[model samples]
Target: MFRDEGYDNDTLEDEEEAIMSSAIPSKVDPLDFVYTNIPDTTHILKLDANCKHCKAKKIVSETDGFCCRNGQIELKQPEPIPELMRLWSSMDADSRHFRENIRFFNG
Candidate 1:
């Protein structure tokens, strides 16, 4: 998106006045890390942990009852998605990709 210097004269703006300067520091308010509108984060974490445990328990119960008949059963704990997975999940393959993946959108 390079601008053509022929049509757009940058000299005009420079001749008028300089805009805001970030170099001169001003006392701006710091960000509020403690959000008020959102629910308790600790409670949310606990709920998420409990939900995962419940799902695993349910899977094990079903597997033990149905599949593990020969007494040779190995319950494999699913490998957790690492931090890098966020990049692929959030940026590379976004909501549009997910919507298509889950059949929420027409192919």
Candidate 2:
């Protein structure tokens, strides 16, 4: 038989307080240390021509292309893997490090 052990509201509140305290730092503005313009750094995509598969607009770069309507179509450049690997290998150590450490943040 299950016996009712009375629910402890005080204990529940204490646990919640403890969790909240640990979740946030009591420090100065954390936002001040972050680079605000980091999100604005982007690659400009050049539109190429109409898509061959769907006859929609084909926006492209040296590596790949995307169609306006045939977005699901894989438009990877011929021998993409080898080309990408070659590009990766050609980059300097610092450049490679920077690319590897790229992160996206949302507020």
Candidate 3:
């Protein structure tokens, strides 16, 4: 069951005031924070390739030419992602994490 109702104008205004008081100080100017064009921060992909299995929307091994996770298809490379990136990626979460290992990715 859901209560489909909205707060009155006064109640909403008081709630906003409370939130503003609890929040961090706001920027003095709209342009105080500067953003610049940057490269991809994290390329979090199970298998970053366009193999037959990947094209079919199925999770696959990152290495060994991006074949299906079934291990029936041929394997190309043992590891495509480097140690740093591999650790950052899910590394077959759909199969490993969902099936056997249970854990959450750290922020």
Cα lDDT for residue 23, candidate 1: 47
Best by lDDT: 2
Cα lDDT tens digits, model 1, 45-93, are: 2222112332332332244334444335556878866743563366455
Cα lDDT computed for each candidate against the true fold = 0.46, 0.61, 0.54
Best by TM-score: 2
Q: Which is superior by TM-score, 1 or 3?
A: 1
lDDT of 3 by residue, 27-106 (tens): 56555455444555877657444555434443455455435564456546566657435444655655455334335443
Candidate 2: C-alpha lDDT: 0.61
Looking at model 3, report the run of 10 residues with the lowest lDDT sum. Answer: 98-107
Residue 100, candidate 1: Cα error in Å is: 3.8
Q: The CA-based lDDT of model 1 is what?
A: 0.46
What ranges in model 1 sit over 4 Å off?
A: 1-66, 83-93, 101-107
Candidate 2 lDDT over residue span 3-103, tens digit each? 34774777777878899999998785778668655775677778776665656654565223344334566545576576456545668775576457645
Q: Each model's TM-score, in the order given?
A: 0.20, 0.25, 0.18
Clashing pairs in 3: 64-76, 64-77
